[model samples]
Target: MARQTPLNEAHRKLGARMVDFAGWDMPVQYSGIIDEHEAVRTAVGLFDVSHMGEVEFTGPGALETVNALISNDLARIADGQAVYAGLLDERGTFVDDVVAYRFSPERILICVNSSNREKDFAWMKAHAQGVAPVDRSDDYAQIAVQGPKAAGLVQRLTKTDVSKIGTYRFAEGEVAGVPSIISRTGYTGEDGFELYCAAKDAVALWDALLTEGQQDGVKPCGLGARDSLRTEMKYALYGNDIDDQHTALEAGLGWIVKLDKATFIGKEALVAQKAAGVKRKLVGFELTGNGIPRHGYAILKDGARVGEVTSGTKGPSVNKAIGIGYVPAELAAEGSTFDVDIRGRAVPAVVVKTPFYKKP
Candidate 1:
């Protein structure tokens, strides 16, 4: 049997179409994918992201232990700040991508993808020298309220002065009378807050927000909208766009790797790869014709397969078929032309700058 979130009943009450995602019964959409996607783009949309995992690190060696495990330098950010990072295996490939929240020198929280929760916890535990990471996945429920009008809607329920929290920052407070860690983070390429509250308070919180934000056109969004939103931003989806076989540098995530920092897992391998130069790079592209690119579609250059699409969609926001794929580093340049073999037809495409959609 698949696990269910605290808001599972709430989703069902609201007529959500549930599907099994990573062993969790999650809503794939409420009203419709395009409607929910547009709601998050122009107004606001609420997402039940309780399926994600959270692990807390504490004790004297917490800071050092966390810093050594991930790619980014957590020390660069102050308390209440979060940094996006990648967890790598010994071979320099991604074990998972995570966001580390620095609460204090002795305390930190790492939020990980739902599907990698168990594997990631084991990896962190085995590599931990002195500090142990405790899985808090069931202890909390997360709700992501996103879009242009998200802040205003959230501000009405929380007394924390939500306007003051900048991107990547969080604060501990009560939202809709429920205690929560209101973090300014989201998977969608929009300004929003990911509110983390106790599991038992999830239904109440969801009810309060939807009831209050009704007039503001807040829609109950789901996984389908989430996927399209992230795709439009070229944000990587773990199983689709990144995995254990690809290094951060090759995935266009080199910016998060701090090679100068103290030795961490995969450090030596990354240094060697950097010196050897990256052979392939991930790039974004737009189809020139009517075809929609899909995952695993062959990317052809000179009528031969040189790469393949990892994520693709007819962007709801951009109104075009866009995709992210890996190709020879030499062919990763902007304006580079290629063909995607979609349904045995060669569909022309061009490599373009990423972030297919940017907030105005």
Candidate 2:
């Protein structure tokens, strides 16, 4: 049996096509994948992301406790801000990628991927020095409103001044009479807010947003659109693009690692790897012709397999076939050419700058 979100019934009512994703029954598309994808690019779209997990740490040294576990420095950001980080094992490979939200020194929250919820809790519990983490996944339902007109549509219902919340920031407020944590963040590369409210309030919030946002052309989005949207932005998907086998540096997530910030879980290994240099890198590429690269497709160099595609798509927004994959650092430079074995037919491809589609 698959776990269902609070908005599962609502999604069915709205004619959503549901599919099993990470052990949850999630909507794959509402109108259509391309339609929902373009809706977010041109106007706005709503997503039910309730399956994501949340963990809270509250008590003295809670901030210090969490900071010691992840690869990013949370001390750099003030309260009400969130930082994307990696939870790594001693080998410097990812345990999971997470977003830490600092509310105060004693109370910080981490939003983790659903697939790693239990694993992360066990890992954190085993290594906790002081404050223990509490799983809050059941307590909240997350709804993402994204695109150019998202802010204005949401602002019409809430008096919290959503515009004041800059990117990577959040505030506790009432949106459509429902208490929520309005976080200025999104998986899709769009200007938007991820509204987190109580599980019981999910239906109300979802209905209100759709009713009010009708004027803004907000469509009910699903995982299919979400995957395509993130892929176009070159944002890594945990299971496909990143896993325990790949280190953060090799995954092109070096920006989140703060080496001088002192002893974190993977600091020693990351430092050693940094000194020795990453032998392979995850690189973004564009197909030269008509083939759409897919996950597990072999990446060939000089007619021999070098790596495999992790995330690939025919970008609806960019109208081009683009993909992300791992290759030797020497073959990762921009314009480096390779071949993707798509369904046993070698398709020529060229490495290019990431973020295949940039908003005009």
Candidate 3:
């Protein structure tokens, strides 16, 4: 049986086409993937992202415990701010990627992908013997408001001044009379806020936002549009872009690693790899012709398989087919050309700068 989010009924009322994703019944599209995608690019679109998992760590050793789990340093993430980092195995393979938010001196929240929730919790628990208590709050519900108009819509509904919150910062407040965590962050390459509220208040918050945003062209968006938007921004998807076999270096997340900070899991291996060299690097590209690159497609250079496509989609906003893939560092430069094996037919592609599309 697939788990349903608290806003499932609201999605149905909006005539969303729902599907099972990683054991959760989620809406894939409402009016259409392209429409919703464009709306988010130009105006604003709301997404039910309650399927994500949240774990809280707070105690005397909570900060110390969290610093040992991921590749990045938590001390750099300021109070009320969030930083993107990866949880790694001993071998430096990515266990999962997460957004760590520092709420206070002793309290912090880690948001992770849903499919790996249990595995992540178990891993943290086993390693957090001396750290603060790790508690799962999967019952909470979340919604993301994304795009240029996202801030405007949020300001109309929330009591706090949206401008007061800096990027990657969050505040505890109310939206439509419902207590919520309004974080100025989003998956798309746009200004937005992600709302976290109690499960029971999920539907009410969703309703209030939709009603308020209706005149501003706010539409109910789904996972399909969300995926495309993130792909356009070159934002990685967990299962697709980063997996257990890839490390932060290979996955293009070296910026988050803080080797100078106190040691953490996979620190030695990362240091070794960084000192020596990395085999491959993640890069962005666009299909040259009419074909659309898909995940798992073989990337060929000089007629030899050199890499694989991780995330690919037809970017509605950019009106092009774009994707992210891993290739040798030598072949990861901009304007580098390669062929993606799409259905056994080689499709020409060229590596371009990341964030294929950024709306101004």
Candidate 4:
């Protein structure tokens, strides 16, 4: 049996189509994938993301200890700020991609993917020389309100001036009388807020938000829409777009890897790879011909396999078949042409500028 999130029963009550995802029974969709996807694109949508894991660290050495494990520079941001970073193995491959919220010099919270919860906690614990990390995943339930109208909807329930909270910043306040962490963050490539409240308060918070946001057309969303939204933005998925077999640099996440920061777990390997140059690189592409690309599809040049697709879908917002894949660096430029092996037939595709969909 899979584990259930605090909002599991609520999801069932809402008639969500449930499926097993990384040992958790999660909703894949409610109304429909396309309807839910467009709800987020045009108006607002609420998502029960309570399965994501949170690990907290506190004490005098928290900053140093955390900075050493992640590739992003924690020193760059002040309190109430968060940063997207990669937790890497010694070989420079991702253990997981995470968001580190800096509450203070002595306190930090890391939000990790549910699929990698246990692995991430164990990895952090093993390297904890000065500060120990506590798994707090079960203590909270996270709700994401996403889209252009998301802020206005969330603002109805919170006392905090959410309009003043810039991107990647957060504040702690009460929402419908329940204490919560209101963070200006989201997985969808849109303006949104992710609220973290006590697990026990999840139902109340969910009900309150739905009631308040009804006028804004906030619909309940599911994992299917989440995957499509992230893919449209070219955001890498852990087991698919990125894995231990592939380094962050090769996965097009080199921007998050701050090699200049004090020695990190993968610094040496990354330095060596940087010097040697990345052999293959991840690139975004759109199908020029008919056919939707899917994961594991072979990417070919002159009918010979050169790479494979990582994530692909019929982009709901762009209304095009798009995908991300690994190819030799020499062929990663925009407008570069390649062929995708779709069920034994070669379909044409072209590398294009990433973020298949951008909010205007």
Clashes of each: 0, 0, 0, 0
Task: Report lDDT per candidate.
Answer: 0.94, 0.94, 0.89, 0.94
Q: lDDT, candidate 4, residue 179?
A: 97
The RMSD of every model to the true structure, in order and in angstroms, is 0.8, 0.7, 1.2, 0.8
Write one digit per residue (lDDT tens) for candidate 3, span 140-191.
Answer: 8999999889999999987799899999899999999999999999998888
For model 4, residues 124-224, the per-residue Cα lDDT tens digits are: 99987789999999998999999999999888888889998999999999988889999999999999999999999999999998889899998999999
lDDT of 1: 0.94
> How good is model 4 by TM-score?
0.99
Worst 10 residues of 3 by lDDT: 129-138
- List residue ranges in candidate 2 displaced over 4 A: none
Where in model 4 is the C-alpha error above 4 Å? none
For candidate 1, lDDT tens digit of each residue in 199-288? 999999999999998988999999999999999999999998889988999999999899998878889999999999999999999999
| Candidate 2: C-alpha lDDT | 0.94
TM-score for predicted model 3 compared with the true structure: 0.97
Quantify how close model 4 is to the true structure by its C-alpha RMSD in Å. 0.8
TM-score on alpha carbons, each prediction: 0.99, 0.99, 0.97, 0.99
